[model samples]
Target chain A: MKTDVSSRVVDKGQKQSHFTANLGSRYTIDRIFKYAAWGATGVSILILVWLLVTIVADGIGTLNWNFITSFPSRRAENAGIIAALVGTVWVMCLVALFTVPLGVGAGIFLEEFAEDNWFTRLVEINIGNLAGVPSIIYGLLGLAVFARIMQPITGGRSVLSGSLTLSLLILPVVIVSTREALRAIPNSLRLAGYALGATRWQVIWSHVLPAAVPGILTGVILALSRAIGETAPLIAVGAAVFISFLPEGLQSQFTAMPIQIYNWVGRPQEEFHYIAASGIIVLMAMLLVMNGVAVYLRNHFQKDF
Target chain B: MTDNVTGDIAPGSWSPKRDRAKAIQTIVKIIFGSFAAISILTTIGILATLIFETIEFFKEVPISQFLTDTRWTPLFASKQFGIFVLVSATMMISVISIMVALPLGLLSAICLSEYATPRIRRILKPMLEILAGVPTVVYGYFALLTVTPFLQIFLPDLQGFNALSAGLVLGIMITPMVASLSEDALYAVPRSLKDGAYALGATKRETVTSVVLPAALSGIVSSLILATSRAVGETMIVTLAAGANPTLGFNPFVPVMTMTAFIVQITKGDAPYGTIEYKTLYAVGMTLFIMTFALNIFSFWFVRRFREKYD
Candidate 1:
């Protein structure tokens, strides 16, 4: 009996050892590929890091106080980016003013008032499609509509036309964000409002709207950031490539940072190229600041519920 | 008792007034709902305009020539109505972009889902998204000033503007989309599969490859397709970095005009609205919109159909 048991134990040990050997070799190969995948991801991050560092180092020298205050000069050597900066600010401000009410109102209507039916579904799908539409298509639309059809209204591609074009482009984004915000609120809150003798409008205005405010603001900021950097649409709507004068009214022509950058980069002069780099830095900074603000708002108001 | 009777109006009597209020509410709802309805209508109208204008363009220029002719010199003469030359350029840039984005995006998804701890993921995910928020115009500048000069040092023949540089910049610009979507997909893979592999004495690497990745493959593939669409539709980076040379060449070293680049080129020039050049812009725009629309619809369907819901 002892001899038989010993033989059986030896057979079991052999099987186990063979299994371990095969498994160990397989694991080694697997680990190699896993690390290889990681290395690829690391390379992408490294590329982005390199880009940020290079931009800061090369563009920072031109971001001095005078660069902030001065306007473009004919010599290119004396040009600053004050006009572009002001135009970007003006465009963003107008974008915010136009998109907020329109987007939020649309969101409220869809989420609170519209019936849960095919028409609502169609609108939802449409909004998603619009969000994916190319920004340059919006540019073409602006060119045809805002710059041409409404030429009698604005007298040409002015600040107002550019802002309206961008506002339309980003409207879907804001509506999506706002709808998500509204959806996050509990159904029980609405039930309680109705129980308290509140009308539908009253419940939305007094309860739901306040709950969704932070989200609405967050969307507005992000949409404005997008509008600010948009060059193609503005270019299509005829943002003057080198507007030396500040825009005095809605009818006056204007140039944003992107147009300014494009104008300078195309020039043969190396100095203008440096100025373009400076303009890029300015545009990047604005985007970063707007994004930061949006993130902060998103985090600050994220409900535990 | 009489006072109580008067106070408690019959429910049937109360119903009429409530119905009246509901009728008013319905009208109010319709009025408010018009905004969303009209916005969608406007979007469709834009697409229709593109279609009509493009059709008009095709009428003026033969469809056979526009589709088949290899050389593109519409500005100089009507003899060249070829769309394929510029389409090839766009494809070249998009192919390069996809080559870079695919592996990086997949691996990043793997890292975020399988390798990183919660603390690391919380920090990294937002940082990756921040890349997406950086404007394409900025990426364009980065390509022109930094990337081009950096590439020039090694390749003496590289032009100041080349497809490779633009494609590289677009690759970076598109990475965030691929990564985010793939991460969401990876996260949806069942954790039980990993546990089962571990119970069978499989290593972490084996579990991720055999169990997790296969399960997430469809979502990852869809993300890649969507990223490809974004690369095609992207205008600013190509317009700035890639020069306006509509040549039928596969060489990434050369500057080439993309569809978007051609639109930018035609629109910038003084082309009248009724002219063939202007209508060609609409034609190219329609093509771009159609391609992107198909991709978008596919992605949406994928998300709706295959996206796993974890209870």
Candidate 2:
């Protein structure tokens, strides 16, 4: 007790304390933590750069006109992605055609038209759940339904099946993004349309939809990009990885860039690996273009809002 | 008042144009309403297809042996229908990926949310998210060709087709999900909490480590859980880089087959439609669906439940 009191008296008397905040390792710890945080961010960026550099370095050699124009071959030098490229374009176009109207219409209904009721809420919640379901599950659904259950329409594992599978895989994304775009429009803008003697449908079509076009287009492009990159669903729908011809029609069998890339990556040859990298380069270019446009659209519209 | 205003516009004027407008509105509403039903119809289709095909699959492979057996050699002569061979592989890859992602993602989130200036974060956030945009198949080849070779230089025994490499690339792929999510969580933590820590003479490190982390723990955990589910559902990366050999082991260095890969594998070949072999695809998908659905619901619940609370 005496020592404690004497120590307290000494501490009170002293102008400087021995155990100060900056007098020890506290500052060092703080700086270290800050640097560690920065380092972690750097590490992720570094990895992305490394992966990109490696892909470009290995794949750029194979990404010539010949590669894009020629068909797949057993010989690595002769192998190309002409068929896969065409199939991917066809699938993307069909996927975009199918998803945009349906997805955007659904988003419009749920956001602007649907009443605040249990059924609307259920649809909303189910959309969220569907967004979380794996792409492969959608593939199985496509296989069972489009390819088999609706055989005549889908032609059982044709381009139609592939595109439908991909559309389902990306439908939730499109709907969610569309809703976001729609939600960005203020309620006052919507109310003004109504106040101007416009019906709900008229208001949505003339004011709400037009104002939100940029955002909606951005969302739609992003969804299409996701669909284009998808492989499993297409594979499950029986996309041929070795096709040498373009899809002649919606009922024609097709292959896509990702499946081709996956096929090459699974091969034992070192050359095929390089070919796989080239396919990835093309796929990445497509994705980047799509995402870039989406980003541009979003930024362009966000300023006014 | 409303009736008076309407009477002023046009008393009892139900013109042909007005009638046509009403009809068009109803048609438009009906069309969009049906569009909305497509999602519900899609869900029913998925569930019905899975259930119907899974029932057929179960008749061929008994549920008991399928669950209890240790082997999963469907293409082999023996034909052991064990599900765990794929389950364990999926788990092993997911575990490795989570191990890689949680730390890196959390740290990156902390950096972006707490440490970096808003200006820096604005640039860094999108840059990190770009990782997510790269297709999984691209990542698969990147893993098989680039990452595996890079790792083989260190662990010479690491197989060319190993879970570690694929999982590592997958970890990189999903890092944005974790970082973006956890950053939102950390950002939601009331600034007052950090101020209190500062008033107590806590350093910046201490304020973040003690005050902020506990507050945002649930969001970080949920993000990690969601990332794990993503890794589980990932197909091409595992299918290409992780090998098709469905071994019942947990070694990260060896080749392992995932359920997604197995489904893709059988369906890629000439498995006759409605046959037992083809039905296996649906069976595997059912398992994958249930696993991911549970994880997603848990993640959703966790995010909703324990997010930061303020007056």
DockQ of all models, two decimals each: 0.45, 0.72
In the range B154-245, model 1's lDDT, one tens digit per residue, is 99999988999999889888888898888888888878878998898676777887888777877887898889888988988998898888
In model 1, the Cα lDDT at residue B226 comes to 89
Summing lDDT over every window of 10 consecutive residues in candidate 2 chain B, give the lowest-scoring window: B11-20
Top candidate, metric lDDT: 2
lDDT of 2 by residue, B162-182 (tens): 999988988888999999999
lDDT of 1: 0.81
Q: Which stretches of candidate 2 lie over 4 Å from their true place?
A: A1-23, A302-305, B1-16
Tell me the spans in candidate 1 whose CA falls farther than 4 Å from its real position. Answer: A1-21, B1-28, B302-311
TM-score of 1: 0.91
Q: What overall lDDT goes with each candidate model?
A: 0.81, 0.87
